[model samples]
Target chain A: MQSTPPGLFRASWLVARKDLAIEFRTRTAFFSTLVFALLGLTIFFFAWDPTTVAAIDLAPGVLWAIFAFSGLLGLQRSFGVEQADRAMDALLAAPLDREAVYLGKAVANLLFVGGVQLVTIPALALFYNVPLAGIALPLAGVALLAAIGLVAVGTLFSSMAVNTRLAELLLPMLSLPFFLPIVVSASMTTARLLAGRPAAEAWPWLRILLAFDLVFGVACTLLFPFTVEE
Target chain B: MPQQPAGPVAASPDDPVVEAEALARQFGARRAVDGVSFVLRAGECLALFGPNGAGKTTLLRLLAGLLAPSSGHCRVAGLGIRDGKLARAHVGLVSHASMLYGALSARENVEFAAKLYGMPDPAGAARDALRSMRVLDRAEAPVRSLSRGLQQRVSIARAIVHSPHVLLCDEPYTGLDELGSAALTEALAERRDSGAALLLVTHNLGEGLALATQAAIMRRGSFVRHENRSGVDAGTYAMEYRELVTLDA
Candidate 1:
């Protein structure tokens, strides 16, 4: 048997790697999230009549909305592959710690959401003619924070939704409510950056995002065992 | 594997792997596992037999530190079930669901589990375990492509990969064929020989009787009879089990 404490980090990383490898092979969550994000952006571009609206004014909301919808798409499929094939029980039975399972799922979600964000960023810049060069670094930081918080809550709720009869329907319903705070902070921060405001002006929203990320991340880590058991 | 000679039993119950006292789990007003108490030593196999809805699964979950008891306490390796992190290190479970990731192959599933338990050489350990279970040929196959019996075998391999001190299995024989069952029986016997306590819940009387050193029958929410294998034959045990359920009804 292995020793404790340090062994836990190894275990968590292994779990995350396994999930990433599987997702990389099938592209199940990745494709769905990417396509959904593109669709969301296209609809908003056409519906808002971006030709009339100032590109800067619409840029922040458009970016935040694309991420939010893409995240929902990824979260919906996060456990879908597991449930379709009945692998969740095997995972629950393994000697691994329950928190590792949460982390593994979270990492998988992050990659899929991040991949969508990577593609959507340049697309949004082109569609709205917003200057992407100025705010790239701060925008990346905000996006990372928002993704962590969103995936943290989504992963927790997805585990619960996967077991229910109405898994597809229930996941969004349960997840969207918990996401309001994250969406607000991310949108506020992005909006400020888009307006060419200095980093100091957006620091408050950054703080809120950091706080949400820490709390939800820890809570999901602790509560995962109860959610995944048979 | 060499067997140990019979020796004098220890007098003190200083560190039982499993200890449940007046444990009961109630869903609303319905008592699922009621007033159950038992202590499992390190080198014993305790079979739990009951019909559907008799709370056998619930009791097994309680012992595995997977569920909270409504009225009593369940301890594994001297740690409370509600202790979360501490208790999980001491217990492992095998249920009907595969609980694996289908997108990944069988090898990846085991390695992932090994990582969760903080095991070194997770891939090597997982490979050896699958080979032992005769599922090595399918190790690289996605779990979705495997048959139910093969999947169950992978589930068993995953359960024992970390070598937990207490093994909790609920209907582990559900999907196994005869050969698969024999291989599983041998694997479990090996674990028992290594001082790991086995707590199993099953509806198959023949398999339960064959694998258990001691067996208990549950009716409604409580155990109605408990006996060692030497004390009762299979025919008499099954008859008594049926009678007990009938009487309760």
Candidate 2:
């Protein structure tokens, strides 16, 4: 019989790797997220007149909104496969820790959603003619931290919503409320960066994102077992 | 010939796999699992029998640490279900639902479970488990494409991947064909041989009688009768089970 290691991080990594491998093979999750994000960007680019509004002004809000919605798509599909085959019972039954499962899903969601953001950012820059040269690294960093918070709560709620009626509709309704703080902070920070504001000015939003990420991530890790239990 | 210990002989009285006292679960006004209590030792397969809504599933969930009791207390592997982190590692569950990822292959599903248990080399463990269940040939195939029987095999493989001490199965045989049932039976026997304490909730008396070393009958959130398999006949046990449930009404 195999024994679980005492460290929580190792278990979380394994879960993340497993989800990544599965996503790589199927491409179902990645492709849907990519298409959803691109479509959102396309609609926004055409909706407002470029002459009337500076594209840079709308860039941060549009980018984060697309990422948020796209991330939800990936998060929904992450657990969708587990629910389809009834594999959750098997996962719950394993001798491993529940915190491991939570962290695994969280890490997987971050990477999957982060991957979507990586793709969406360049596309948004190209379409809007905005220069991403200086802010790309910070933007990506902020996106990842914010994704952690969104995925943490989203993953927990998805487990519950998947078993209910109208899961597709229910998940967003349940998750969106919890996601407001993340969306606000991420958009505010990203907008300031895109507007060529000084780093010191954007630091407040960065701090909010950091604090939000830590509190929500830790809380979700603690609460996941209750949500997924039979 | 003397009866042999099926697997490892658990130490006596020092620890019980399961111990419950006045355990109960109430949903709204309804008492789903009410004032129930029992003890299960390692290397024992205890069959839980009841009609639908008889609270058999509820009791099984409570033991597995999947559901919390509204009143009273229960412990699994000396850990309380309320201690979700500690208790979950010692308890495992298999149910009518497969709980697998359709997009993932059988191997991936099992490997994912291994990883969740914090096992290193999840791929190696998954491969060995699938091979043991005779489903290794289809390990690379997506679960959505596998037959129901094969999917159940994957489910079984996934459950034991982490090697939990206590296994809780609720109607594991529900949609299985004869061959599938036979396969599941063999797999379960293997688990039992490993000294895992199994708590099974099933409507099939024959399967329960065949697998269980001990059996308990439940109705309306309580256990009315329980016995060792060698101590009762099938016909008599079923008749008594029906009588007990009806007696209360």
Candidate 3:
């Protein structure tokens, strides 16, 4: 005698909306991650001599490295929220597709990581004096692709790590390896695009990002149900 | 307090809402729930009483499809438990944990669940459930801000918002005060009257027996005594339960 449950995509959105609503109110993870990313950008700026490594050359690597680490902070808390009152059990018992749970969390993480990037990228550009006037659009496109890949894999590992005793340590340890390809591909593309190199030169790296997103996205969504319960 | 009907009750008493056949769950070498089986038809309530760590919670988890059984099978609302989407829509669960977002207001928490169940009017359902549980006054307050009893009330509201055909509750009386307990008792009676199948796990023998149509005393992963409530004397059930639990210990 119950109403039909929402469709998969709609259920996913509901989960996302719920997470976003909580995040909006608390803002603990989001704010902390953003601050850590901005702080990392600042430290990286002072660590290297501009004379030896040009800010433009150093900026892409620094940006992605900060993005990568900051992402772990957000991902670490993604499933951790559910552990508070065993809320994950409620979610697990729900009639929605498990994939919806994974996608919902992933979307929330993407936005969280992206929100940090939204603020941190401009901060990186400002601190390192990387010219953004000409390449803003392509750079953003690269960031979005890289984020999708990072979130897809990171969200999966986050779910796994959350159940462990050493979730904080486990998340970064398990995720960094998977994040390697994404960071490498993104930074390479960013470096080329920043150098005013032809867009054709970055095509291979972009393809790698695309391939990583496609392969891991589907694979992670499928594997998520296994990580949840017995 | 009888609630306004949340939804239409099952039309047939013979329709089984929950069924388990030889259900078993193991953790490493430990058999938490071993070869347990039961059937709960419409309007039936099964109150399970057991000592701590006797596998009562494990059995409930297996039935709810929260934990995959090591062996055997179960169905909820005539759908295989393995078919989660279809089975779970017909089920609701309340555990020791509130299973709520502490940051969200009470109303929002129930609304989230209603939306998940795809109720047509999530806000209205949440309102009615909260009102029924006597927590509507605190609907806008964050769950974390509420007292323990109030939190439990809100938890009940969330569980019943969809008017699930099967309700699985584990120690649902935890943190509730006397008034809260009475309210829960009434709610359970009303739900039973409305044809929802319930599996309640509790340590309170009196409270459990009062609402149970069928009762089971589980020990060491298996039921030592299970029978219809009418066949068991309420005065002696506590003594019997203690003896059974003591025998296992």
Candidate 4:
């Protein structure tokens, strides 16, 4: 009746393209996330007296904080879109691999959250007077690793929260606990990397971030079917 | 429309496209679908009528592969419901919800579905579906901007873009105006005439009675009455359906 279903990877790409196209056309998730990150940066900038604290000390926390919360905003919207008119019901009924849905959502969240950071990191660097010229490349590597863990767990939790009575309050509560470890590791590594510390010194923390990425990425992808089941 | 087929159709009965046996689905302490079974052959349209909490939705979901039966199994389009790929490929569902991306234009929404199913010419298929639904004039408009009636039309277009072997519609006529409802009736009739098996769940006896080759009434997760449409008296059945639907099981 139908052509053979595409491989899991190809199916995921289709789903990812759908989400990306929606986000691009509507700009709802994209602008909301960008604005949230920018607002958080401004508040933190004005709340603290830059004269008393050095930008190097402030830059690490500020960067990850912006990344995490803005990512939460994007993750929330990712599933929120599915809730409109129960669009998710149609998606679940489709014959594609269940894992493809999880992977597609994770990838979309990664790109959205990643896009916000790509802009915010540079802006924060300019405002905080932190010298990121030499380390921008390496710092990006750390951010990418940390993002994988956040998007993986966030996508799973968002799926769970949307089914609950109070999704607005529930998603952050369910996801924040999982997000803590990655944020901590990323912040510490970013702090060291910015301080001109040798790459070897930050390797241990990077390993922890890498492990979190691997563990949850695989676990969440496999667990998605159970969570999505009717 | 003819009367009921008289008995359960077998799994491989002369090209039986839909076959279910002892299908039961339980949710916590509630048995949503209890030991139900049926079969639908090509060109058959089975209209399911029931009250709220009668498990009609659950039954349709089970057949559409949207929900898994807890105890029994069924085959759709010659593949088990658990066979997500081939089973889903052969089915299309139109529910109260539009199940469309509100931000995307009507044409874009159907095209996305076509592409999702690996159709080679998504654009042309989308155009054909929209034209059939008579919303081709507004094809460029976003679904959110359209009226509820028009949105339902788009939903129908999206569901049938693949021309699936089985069409599952759960209250597809809900929220439609008089004209909209009439349009839906015609659309559904056309879909049935295309040789697709249909399982339409609704509270409207008149609408249900009109399109079904066989009609079934469900109560508390089981079918209490199923008869051939040709034998059913609409005026008398409507009166009985109203009374029976209001009574607590």
Candidate 5:
């Protein structure tokens, strides 16, 4: 008798878990992203004339810029990992729910991007000599929202890019257009929060980021099945 | 010994587990699968022989639901492959691609496949399948660390971890040496003996004919000839295939 396929949540969890297991084992993608983000920050540190520029003003954009670009490395690894042995063929051929695969992959990308951010945020704070003081929670909130948006579109484009011959060149070209809104909103929100502006001022950007997240999250989750389908 | 051409009636004792009726898949101005059809009974294996670009892999992909047929219908265990989940639930594929996570241990890779299929006992089933492929001793080794032949064995283990009712293989022995090839043949035989219907596409006449209950030679996306394996010996088949392939070329 044939076995039952896992439910959406379970299957998605399994996919995410499997990817995480492999990522943890190799740490190739994870550390590369971490190092890239740190390297970007170091460049931003020297590039910015902190004596003349407001550290708070420059730091937010620098942080988001680093996060956005470094996140691509993680997103690229999303489906690139599956290509190692064409393991994706097995995933596609299985009785798997395509959406489950997408959600799982997106979530896994979210975590990887999140991991890079977790370290990058504090490190950026230290490098730029900015204190989180009162806005750490909201800073993290903004980071989370921005990451959801990044992974939503990143996951979609990653699936598409990997199938194309120009995969390496194509992913950034494809995802950057969609990711700009998040980068802009994230940097804007972080700027306000870092500047000690009232929650009311940064609120709109957060809402925009949240909306971007929900819209792309649902759409990408639904559209991913077709993106990877043969 | 197998009897008669395997159309849709050979060994009707068990219902046909896989049925393809005039299945065709087209790509841009080309028809990759031009109206091929077959019925495979449980415990039956069909070894399809073809030259390069003969659509053998395309046909297997069509059945695996990786590609949809442009026309006609195909089903596994009475359910449509295009439909939600049933087709995938009963089918397993072992392609030339090992389809594994290189960073993952062999056991972990099989466990992942079992989990996707929602097996009742994923760990136990994974171990059992790995052991069956004779790679259980290396189960803890990362797949990348294993030899190509051992990796092939792990791929076989992963494909069969769920005990699928139907197996679709596309040149599974591409990188195997003699030992690897023997292990794969044994794995296919075990699946066949367990009443799983199999469709294997290969260029290895000796091995393909050895395990096939029915066999066919395909050219330009169509089956030119199909006959019972019982009466079709390898030497005659190799000669006929060479002549047909040359003429087509």
Candidate 6:
């Protein structure tokens, strides 16, 4: 007798757990992302004249910039693991709904991107000498909203580019277009929040991020099955 | 003993766990699978022999629902492969690749499959599958750390964990040694005896013939020869196969 499949939520969680477990074991992608993030921040800090332009102004742009690039590193490796032995075929052949695969992968990517942000935000504050005394929670809130948008689009493109000859190159090339709106909105929101401006001042940019997240989140989940279907 | 060809019957059996009707797939302008068709009922095994690029893998993929057929349809347990979730629940595939996570332990890999299939006790199911494949001792070892043969056993364990009704295997014997081959043969036979319909694609004629109740020789994108195993003369089949393959070449 054949077994029934788990519900979409359970199946997606299982996939996400499997992915995070593998990432935890190797630490290849996560470590590289950290190294790249820290290295990128150090260079950005020194490249500009902090004396000429306030460090506070550069912090928001620098944080989001580093976050975007480093998040790409994580996204590129997301579906790459499934290619190790064509383990993806087993996943595709399973009885679970295809959206579960997308949701699981996107959730794992969200956590991955979120983890990188957790470290990079503190590093940004230290290197750029940007004060975070009263705005840390709002800063984290903006980062979470931005990450949802990033993972939604990045995970979809990652799945599409994984089987190509130049996956590393193809992923960024395809995803950067979709990521532009996210980065712009996030940086704008962060700038307002970092300036200790009224929460109302940042609402418009936050709305853009929220809209991008909602639209792409549902669209990517629907489109993901087509990318994996051959 | 000599045997005669048992040609295609006018009608299918009452219960066919796997059925492919006029299935075809095209790549660019090339027809990888050109209108191939067959049926296997409960407890039946069909060993398909073909040369490289003869469309055997494409056919299997189409039936396994990995690749959508450009035209035609196939079914598992009377459910169309394109019928979605429930249909896939009835099928398992073991391809040339191990299809396993290298960083995951053998036990973890099997358990992952069980959980995806919604088994109530994934850990127990995984342990049972590992023990059955004779890899229980290495359950905690990372798959990448194990030998190729051991990894293949784990792959099989993962594929069978859900107790699928139709099993598809492509070049399953690729890297096995004497002992590994024996173990695989035993496992496959056990599955067949338990009423799972099977489609096995292999280049190893002797091994395939040993387990096949039905057999087919594929060339290009079509079946050049097909018959029941009882109708074949084991001693002469190798020579006949060589001639057929050479003629096609």
True contacts kept of each: 0.39, 0.56, 0.75, 0.44, 0.76, 0.76
Runs of candidate 5 exceeding 4 Å displacement: B1-14
Candidate 4 deviant stretches above 4 angstroms: A50-52, B1-13
Give the clashing pairs for model 2. A85-B100, A86-B98, A86-B99, A86-B100, A87-B98, A87-B99, A87-B100, A88-B99, A96-B117
Which tens-of-lDDT digit does each residue in B1-249 have in candidate 2?
111211222356446777889999999999999899887887778899987788987787777666778989987776776664556666667877788877788998887776666565678878877876778999999988998878878887777766667778889887677866887788777777776788888888889888898899988898878788789799988888787767666
What's the TM-score of candidate 3 when only chain A is evaluated?
0.98
TM-score of each: 0.88, 0.87, 0.97, 0.93, 0.95, 0.96
Candidate 1 lDDT score at position B17: 72
lDDT of 6 by residue, B1-249 (tens): 111112121134556788889999999999999999898998899999988999999998898888999998998887888887878877888999999999999999999998887776788888877887888999999999999989999998888887677889999988887877887888889888977788999999999999999999998889989999999987788888888888867
lDDT tens digits, residue span A80-150, model 6: 99998999999999888999999999999989888888888888888887888688888889889999999
Quality class of the docking in candidate 3, CAPRI style: medium
lDDT of 2 by residue, A55-104 (tens): 88888888877777787788887777667655655555444477877888
Of models 1 and 3, which has the larger TM-score? 3
Candidate ordering by lDDT (highest first): 3, 5, 6, 4, 2, 1
What's the lDDT for all of these models? Answer: 0.78, 0.79, 0.88, 0.84, 0.88, 0.87
What interface RMSD does candidate 1 have?
A: 6.7
- Candidate 1 lDDT score relative to the true structure: 0.78
Docking class of 4: acceptable
Q: What is the lDDT of candidate 5?
A: 0.88
* True-vs-predicted CA distance for residue A88, candidate 2, Å: 3.1
Instruction: Give Cα distance to truth, residue A75, candidate 3, Å.
Output: 0.5
lDDT of 6: 0.87
- Scored by TM-score, the top model is 3
Candidate 5 C-alpha lDDT tens digits along A46-76: 8889679989889988998888889889999
Can you tell me which runs of candidate 1 are displaced by over 4 Å?
A1-8, A79-100, A195-197, A214-230, B1-15, B246-249
Q: Candidate 5: deviation at residue A2, Å?
A: 5.3
Q: Distance (Å) between predicted and true CA of A16, model 4?
A: 1.6
Better of 1 and 2 by DockQ: 2
lDDT of 2 at B236: 88
Every model's Cα RMSD, please?
4.0, 4.1, 2.1, 4.0, 3.8, 4.9
Candidate 5 chain B lDDT trough over 10 residues, lowest sum: B1-10
